[model samples]
Each structure stands twice: as structure tokens, then as C-alpha cells.
Target: MLAVIRERYRAHGFDEIETPVMEEYSRLHAGIGGDNEKLAYNVLKRGLDADAIRGAAGDPAALTDLGLRYDLTVPLARFYATNRGQLPSVFRSIQIAPVWRAERPQKGRYRQFVQCDIDIIGDASARAEAELAVATLDTLDALGLEGGSIRINDRRVLDWMLDSFGFTSDERPGVLITIDKLDKLGPDGIVAELRERGATAGAVDAFAAFLRRPTTLEYNPYGERQIRKALPDGAPDDIVAHLVGIGAAVAASRGSATELEGDIPLVFDPFLVRGMGYYTGTIFELAHPSVDYSLGGGGRYDGMIGRFLGQDVPAVGFSIGFERIVDLVSERTDAAAPAVVLVHDRDVPEGELLALKAALVREGSRVRLEQRTKNLKALLERAASDGYTAFATVAQGTTPASLEVKPLA
Candidate 1:
């Protein structure tokens, strides 16, 4: 599974890099507030008892602790800082590894799940943002997602709307958080939550209306195809406009068919609050009807690296939820791991077995050889019953020079 995802990123010109799973507490906190920050699993060294560490701080507020990385992006930024000289001017990297979060496990969400992240750093161009979206789309496309669309929004656009409404700093956070729940709770639910949270009725109504309407292509060709046949062509373009515009910019820059004009669908959505403070520019989420969970999502954070580097460096990325993708792909396709059959013939001496195994391995084949008292015919039958793709004989007519290989199917 890791290899499949790694190949996808590598084909897109992303360098595969390894970063430590354990990170400093400060580096791990990317200001993605609310339950996100609390979800990180903190680490304490062995021999340092939890009670002692808690007591060492004296005051509850001043403990500098370490934590297992909550996500790959934060540690990737740290990696860039540490290896500034060795890395390329424009760093495009991919990491596939386990990330720990303390969130409640439910449905497809887990405390220990693999997050496949692809990021581009040091370039603030809209091209970076578009490329990130395209890469994410391509990854899903490879996984056989035929009916989903990539919904995108810009944090700048969201902030613009909030500031335009004259929301107070204290009020904006709650409002944005509630507005983020537009999908689950619906417009009416958001209005109620906002009203309870002290937002003016007018503000809540306007916010709900804004979310319901989004920008898009001039003709409702795609919208009609998606929502219904009776919807008007001039339906609000709020979300569609933003996504199509970014996608256009990306297409104009890269000249790739996967851009705005490409067949890969792009949907605009104002209510896509990605639940991260680090996102500064374009944001996106991938959704498909086959699965309820997001395949994975990410966006551009222009000055995110500057928060650590002192000088601003633009960055954009998207993470592919390996488990979600695997789940979706499994449902739609018959792709499964290849099986290897162990071929052991008692006629072959044990001394020459190692050479035969090595030769098969050198040919890029998966081989399994274990001692078995059963005859070759029974072994082959068992291999077939077990769904092995190919079978190999340990010894061929008492000559140990080569393996007897044949396709099981």
C-alpha cells in the first residue's frame, strides 16, 4: 500500500523523503486550533516518569515536552530548515508514514493511521496551489474515483467575507467554526448555533446564504449534471468561481489538461472551512459519493514556513488518506496485493536452496520457500487454492542451477 502511494507521488515529480516521527512540541503545533491541537499524542522519554515530568514543571503552564508528529507537514518544515543547504531551491517532497492523533476513533477515523502527504515549499505561485490540487485529483483518479469533484475555497476569500461583515476578533473564530459545520448541520443548524453563540441574526442568515450559493462556470452544464436538470444556468457561482479560477490559473501556467478546462471536475464551496489556521491562500477537499469520508485534503499556506524560518517561504500541499483511498478503491476495483507461492521440493538438497532463492529474488520476483513434507503436486494445489499468482520449484531434476518457475493461473 505504501509503495502504491509512493509511486503515485514519485510519478508527479515529488521526491520521497523521510522525517522523524517524534517532533518537538513547538514544531508539532501548527496552530490548527480546537480539537486538532489536543489530538496530538505527546511523548515522554523512557525513565522520565510522567508524574516526575509533571512535577518538574512546578507550574502547570511551562513544560517543554516532545510529541509524536500529528502530521507530516510540520516536521517537513523543520526538515527544510535543518537541511537548507542540501535541498533544492524548490522542494517538492512526499512522505508516507504513520501519524498519531488522539482524536476519538469513529467510522473511518483512527488514532493511528497512515497519512500520505505531498508538499511543495519555497514557491508562493498560484501554480503551486493548482498543482497541489491537480496532484490530489490525479491520485484519486488513479484510485478509480469517477464521480467525485474537488471542492475548493480560498482563506483570503473567507477572511474577506468575515472582515467585510465587520466581525469582531473574538466573534470571528466562533462564527467561522460554526460556519465550518455547514455541511453536517445544514444552513439552519449553523444559524441556530451562531445565534446561540451571540452572532446577530442578520449575520447568521447572510453567512448561511453565502454558503448555499457559490461561483462556477458561466453555464450550469456541470451543475445541472450534478445537482439536477431543472436548476437554472445562472445559479450562484461562489464556490465554482474560486475553484475554476484557481484551476484556470494553474492550467495557464502548467498547460496541463488536468486543470480547469480539463475533464476532472472542480466545484467551488464557501463552507469548506478546513479547520486549520495555517492555510493562508487556496484550500481544497476531495469528496466522492462512494465513501462518506474525505479522501484527504490540503491547501496553500504562503507564510507557513516563514513562521519558523524568520523569512517567509511559500508552501502548498495536500495529504491523501491512505486508508480512505484504499477503502474506496477496494469497493470499486478488484485490485489486491499479489500473492507469492512457496515452492519446496524435498528432492532438492538444503545446501543449494539459498542460491535458488537468491536468483529468483534478483529477478524482481516475490518468492516464498518453506520446508514441506508434501509432494510437488500437493504443494502446487495448495498454492492455487491460496490464490498464489505463480509457483516455483526449488530444484529442477536434481540440478540446483535454476528454479522451475511457472504461472499458477
Candidate 2:
């Protein structure tokens, strides 16, 4: 599955890159990862005595200088800053690696897992967002999955909506966090929670009224009309236009056609607030009808690189939840080499058996040597379960041409 994703990414002109799993403690805590920061695993500083550890005023920096990365984007930002001179002006990179989070494990969630990410840096246009959306959809198709769609919303629009509702900048973050729980909390619960959070009463009332307003959220292909319908009158014109441009581009570039409006999977989600704080513009999540959660997601973080270089560089990335999608894949598109087992007798010389195996390998076969056992049926069943397609008996001086291979039942 990882190979499939890697090949798909490379086919899209993204160059593979690697970064260290560990990063400086400061960079990881740079206030961008949202709740993931709280979940980060901080390493204790080495050579600290029990008293020294207790004496550090409970500051994490006092205890640790480095920690494992919680996501790939932060490391990528640092990588671009450090290697900007050598990379292309418009760089496309592939990062397939494991990231660690110190959160409690849950079903379909792990403390350490692999993420398959493709990022485009140095392109600020809607084309950057479009390319990311199209490429991710293509990769999902390559994995033999179906009914994948991208739900997109811009940070600008969210901020605009909040401000229009009279939310102060200070209240915006907390409001967005509660808004993110709309699916679980519902409208009334959101208003109640906001009031409990001591949000300005008028702002809460305004927000509640907007939520209660009549809006048709029916199945419509995400376009200008659906986008307008989802938001109040007088939403930012530039953000709306930018989203429309991305939809049109994705529709044109997509590999498959559908009956959905515009025949594109792009949909405008007015309430889709991705938790990553660094996302400065166009945020998106990949959804498949098969499951309730997103298979992958990403967005533009045009300001992140600037933090390291003292100048902003536009960047957007999409990461497939590799662990979530692997089990959901029912079929594989890439064919594996034929696997063959050498069921050999004890009397056979180890060197001769190895020679036979090597000969088969040179001919493009995956060969495994197994000693002949009395329970031949059980051995063959185990081999079949392990994905060996065929087996052959080997004896003294048996050559590749002389061995007759039989297919496993």
C-alpha cells in the first residue's frame, strides 16, 4: 500500500524527501499544530538529576531540548528553509514517514503512524490548491477506492463570518473550536457552550440566529451557487472566487466523471474548520461515503515557511491517513512477482538448495526455502496463507529447470 501511494505521488512529479524524526523542542511548540501540540511526546533532557528535573519550575524547555515530530508539515517547513538554495523555485515534495503523538490510543488511531503527504511549495495561486485536490483524488482512485470527495472551506471565510457575527479576535479561536464540534454538539449545544465560554452575548445571539436561518444544504455539486447558499449574504467576494476557480480546475483535471453538479468532488463546506492553526487559506478534507471520517486532508499554510526564512513562501499539502485507508482497500492495482516456495528434503545440500532459489530469483520470482516436513498438508496451507502461489520439491543437485512447480490450492 505504501509503495502504491509512493509510486502515485512520484508519477505526479513530486520528488521524495526525508527529514529527521526528531526536531528541536521549540519548533514543535511553535503554536501551529492546534491540539496536536498538547499530544506531543516531549523527551526529558539527558543527564538531569532527580532534583534538577524537579527544580526546573515545571517548564518543558527546562526539561527537554528535542522532541519527535507530531506531523510532517513542520519538518517540511524547516527543511525548505534550510535547503531553499538547492531546491526548485516551485518545489513538489513527497514525504512518507511515521510521526509520533503521545495521545491515548483509540480504534483506527495510534500514537505512531505513517502519513503519506505530497506538498507544493512556492505556488500561491488557486492552482496550488487545485493540484493538491486533484492529485489526492487520483491517488485514492489508484488505490481502488471509490466515492471520494473533497470538502473545502477557506480560513478567510471563517474569520469573515465570525467577525460579521461580532466575535472579537480573542473569541474567534474558541468559537471555531466549538464550531468544529457542530456534528456532535448541534446548534443549540454550540450556542449554550459559547455562552458558557462567556462569548459576547450579541455575538452568540447573532451566531445562533445565523445557524437557525433557512439554508438548503441539499446534494449540490460545490460551485458558486452552493457556496453562496451556505454562507450569509455579502461573504468575501475574493474568497468565493478563489474557491470557484479551484473547483473548475479540479473538475477539468479529474480522471473520472460523475453526475454530480460540475462532475467534480469539490464541495464548499461553510462550517468545515480544520483544526490546524497554521492553515492561512483554503482548507480541505477528503471524505469517502464508506466511512464517517476523512481519509486524508490538507490546506495552504503560506505563512509557515516565512517564520523560518523571514519571508513567506506559499505552501499547500495533502496527507492520506495511510493506516485508515490500507484496510479499506479491497483490491490492489500493482501486481507482485510470483512467489514460490522450495519444499526441500533434509538430505538436500543447503548450497544446492540456495543455488536453485537464487536461480529462480534471477528469473524474477520471490523464493522462500522451507524444510520438508511430515505434515506436508499443513505446511502447504501455511505457505498459501503467507501468499506463496506455488511450491516445488528440491533434492540433491536439483536445478531450476529440473524442478516442477505445483500451484497451491
Candidate 3:
């Protein structure tokens, strides 16, 4: 699977690079990563005076200057900024590596896990978004996953929705954080949580009603009408156009042989508020019917790099949740049996045994060499249990001659 991901990403002209796992603590807490900042594993300051460390023990910030990265995107942003002159004007990058988070571990959620990401920095066109969506869907299709869907929503559209619902600018972030949990907490649960967070009952009721509306897909005139009605009279035209353009692009790409199209639905989901604080434009998630959680997600973050470089650099990225995809794929695929196992008598020459192993490997077979034991039957039984399908036994009298081979029962 990793090989397939590398091939797909490289085929799209994305150069694979790696960044350090630990970043400066201040860089990790730049207010763009949302909840992930709180989950960073802070590294304690080294080579400091013992007295100073004891004095700053109450305030960890003074003692910590580094932290384990929570995602690949932020580190990429920093990398691009520092290496801008060395990279192409429009940089497409692939980073497949592990990130750390100080979070509770669950079935598919872990503190340490690999993230498969492909990001295009310095491209502001909606085409970037379209290409990313298509490439990601194609990759999933190549992996034999079906009946999945990509639920897309623009952050501007979400902002408009919040404004239409009378949520103040100050209330927006808190409200968005609550809305992000809608999948786990149903509509009623969301409203209850909102009210608990000091939102007015009227606002909560209105938001709840809006959430109850059925999900809208592209090219649905009625759905567009609903969106228009829900948005303010003067909602930004560019945001609306960008949203329409993405939907059209995705719909058109569905016809291509590379994409799964009808089998994997791509629809507009107005209520999706991805938890990331950096998302500035279109946001999306890939989900499969068989999986309860999202398979992966990403979006545009136009302003993030500007924080470091003092100039805006448009970026869009998509990351597949490596652990979740692996889990699903593992469940669907059959375990492969070993090609062959080599059994040699105790008196068999070591040189002959090595020669036999090399010959089998040259034949493109996976071969394992084991010394014969008094419990020969038990050894073979164990090898069979370990998934070896065939066995070859070396004759004691042969230096580099014939051997006996048998298939496991």
C-alpha cells in the first residue's frame, strides 16, 4: 500500500521529502493547528541550570522549547518558507512519515501513527483542489475500496452559515469546534453542548434546524436554492463561485476511467466544520460506508505560510489516515502464504544450505532455512502453522545436489 501511495504521488510530480519530528515549541503553538496544539508532546529544555529549571517548573513554557509535530502540513509550511529559493515556484510535495500526539489511544487512534500527505504549495487556483480530490479518490479506488464518498464544504460557506445563524465572530470558533463533533454527538447533542458553552437558546435552535436539513450535492438546483436562502444577501461572490467550481470539476472528473465516480459519491456537505483553524477555503473528507470515521481529509490554507514568511503562499493538501486505511485494507485482503521453507539435516554443509537458499531466492521465492531437529515432524508442523506452504529438505549425503520437496497439508 505504501508503495502504491508513493507511486501515485510521485506520478503527480510531487517530490517526497522529510522534516524533523521535533519543531520549536513556539512554532507548534502558532494558533493555526487548533486542538492539535494542545496535544503536542513538549520536549523539556536541556542544558539549563537546575535552579532555573526548578524555578520554571510551575510554568512549563519556560522549560520547554521543542515539541513533537502533530501533522506534516505545518512542518512543510516551515520547510517551504526556509527553502523557498531552492524549490520550484509551485511546489508539490509528498511526505509519508510518523507524527506524535499526546492523546488517548483507541482502536484506530494512536499517539504515534504515520500520515500519508500530498500538498501543493503556492497554487491558488481551484484546479489544485480539483486535482487533489481526483488523485486521492483514484488512489483509494486503486486500493479496491468502494462505496465511499467525499463530503466537501468550503470554510467561507461555513462562515456564511454561522453568520446567517446569528453567531458572532467571537462565537464562531467555539461554535465551529462544537459543530466538528456532530458526527460523534448527534444534532440534539450538539445543541446541548452549544447551550452549555453559553450560546443563546434561539441561536442553538436555529442552528439545530439548519443542521437537520438533508445533505446537498452539486448540480442540485433545490440544494443551491436552500444554500442561497440560508446565506446572507451579500455573501462573498468569490467564495460561492469557488465552491461551485470545485463541485463542477469533481463532477466532470467522475467520468474519467481513473476515478470511481458513481461507486464513490462526492457531495456538498454544508455542516462539515473540520477542526483545523488554518483552513481558509474548501474543506473535504473521504468516508466509506464500512468505516465509521473519516478515511482522510484536508483543505486550503492560504494564510498559514504568511505567518512565517510575511507573504501569502497558497497551499492545499490531502492526507490519508494511514492507520485507518491500513485497518480497513487488512480486514478486506487475504493473508499471503509463504513461498517455501528449507529444512536441512544437522550434518548438511552450511555452504550447501546457503547455496540452496540463494537458488530459491533467485527463482523469486521467499525461502527460510531451518536446521533439522530430532522433532522433524514438529518443526514442519510449526512451519506450516507460520504460513509456509511448501518445504524442501536437504539430503545429508549431498554437497550441492538434489533435495526432497513437499507441500504442506
Q: Best TM-score goes to which candidate?
A: 2
| C-alpha TM-score for every candidate | 0.80, 0.95, 0.86
334 in model 2: Cα distance from truth in Å? 6.7
| Alpha carbon deviation, residue 19, candidate 3 (Å) | 1.3
lDDT of each: 0.69, 0.89, 0.81
In model 1, what is the error at residue 63, expressed in angstroms?
4.9
Q: In candidate 2, how many Å is residue 13 off?
A: 0.8
- Best-to-worst ranking by lDDT: 2, 3, 1
Q: Choose the strongest candidate by lDDT.
A: 2
List the candidate numbers ranked by TM-score, top first: 2, 3, 1
2 or 3, greater by lDDT: 2
Candidate 2: the clashing residue pairs are none
Q: Candidate 2: global Cα-lDDT? A: 0.89
Candidate 2 lDDT tens digits, 286-369? 999999998989999999999999999999999999989988987432135778999999999878988899998998888899
Q: Judging by lDDT, tell me the better candidate of 1 and 2.
A: 2
Tens-digit lDDT track for model 3 on 291-362? 788999999999999988999999999999888888676423233534688887788777878888887777
